[model samples]
Target: MTQNKAAPQNSVETYTIYATSNKYNRPPPPSTVALHGMDLIGAPIDIRNHRFFHPPPSHLMSTTTDLIDKLKSSLAEALELYPPVAGIVEVNEKGEFYIAMNAENRLGTPFLVEIKDTPYVGDSETLSPRLDMLLPPSSSALAVKLTQFSCGT
Candidate 1:
């Protein structure tokens, strides 16, 4: 696993946000799971899993920070159970790819939080370009982002 770094922010954009990795509290047991032939065949493909939620009500808005903190903590705990999510795919000397995990190298999952001053009105069903902004940059395994809109959605 390699050290995780936040992608550079674009000064031109005004959204307030920050990125960080949510690592397991305790290192997961060491293991290397080799990818099967079928897995390797689809390795080059770009697959994304995204989900969005409605913003909290104005009365509960004050807990936004608490909500984000809870999310990060829960993600870390989940990584402890599913260690492979915290692992990275790497090419071995044989040029074969496998998910590698060890105590020495823990590449945690990327977690991002963004606050948009505008309401979110993008069509969730259509492949709208605007929806792409909700996800973190590409990673070998997993990435998550939470976007909160000011209009409460």
Candidate 2:
């Protein structure tokens, strides 16, 4: 990852990109999947799952490109199996929420790579100040973020 020359040394920086399934893979049928009763139970609540991983050995992943490539590839393959994850959440005419996807125009998942100048400490009880920036828009069905610390953890 290239550093931004204008950014402050201690400020957090992020690179945003999109990842899509392989073009050769069969696309999902163009359809609208309505949210059932169980799905509607938590419709008003927003929840996110955050995961962190320790850096691999230098020999395995020596550069940031390798890490980003692997992640994008993996996510693409996963999308092939679960196409709904790449869909957008939309409201129907009757005020019902559903996932919508088009075979001809696939909406890829949002992928973010955050570079931190400092080493990562354990998760704190308090929410992060940049939490809003780290998450995808509410309309998106899925997203992924990879945070790389200067200390490689």
Candidate 3:
């Protein structure tokens, strides 16, 4: 297996958010109360790191604005299939924790589209320090960030 090394910081000029998408095509219906074993496994913490990256195709490239638009549109469509992801978790009056599944998310997902201005370097980097900052505060259950590098990645 090949380990991907971090890209040289010299190539990356800066990272900035150009747009935000918090829209869902259709509101999610009220869902039944439920609990997850994983949610209970630890000391009731829910922060986990699962990161991956795909380098931009060498041939075709899209602008940052266009990439953000496409991502926003795709997220709206995806919510239709996975409604729960758009819901929230809460504990009932009885003091038992459960997921509300109600489509009533204050902000569906703090979806952020960021742009990284850099020279067109063929290779890519993983585990960027800025990646952590891109995520919203840990209060929300779901958060997403789509970063488009200068190479239209």
Report the number of the highest-lDDT candidate. 2
Model 1 stretches astray by more than 4 angstroms: 1-28, 56-62, 124-140
Off by over 4 Å in 3: 1-28, 36-39, 44-62, 118-139
Candidates by TM-score, descending order: 2, 1, 3
- Report the lDDT of model 3 for residue 3: 100
On TM-score, the leading prediction is: 2
Which runs in model 2 stand beyond 4 Å of their true positions?
Answer: 1-27, 103-105, 125-138
Give per-residue CA lDDT, model 2, range 77-101, as digits (tens). 7776676777777776698877776
Per-residue lDDT of candidate 1, residues 2-117 (tens digit): 99765434222222112223353454366788888888653253345556777567577568777777677777677667777777677788988787776444556667676655
Q: What is the C-alpha lDDT profile of model 3 across 61-149, one tens digit per residue?
A: 36445555566667666655565565556666776666555434433655655455564455344423334533333234565655555
The CA lDDT of each predicted structure is 0.58, 0.63, 0.50
Model 2 weakest lDDT span, ten residues long: 125-134
Clash number for model 1?
0
The lDDT of model 2 is 0.63
> Is 1 or 2 the stronger prediction by TM-score?
2
Positional deviation of 10 in candidate 2, in angstroms? 5.7
In candidate 2, clashing pairs total 0
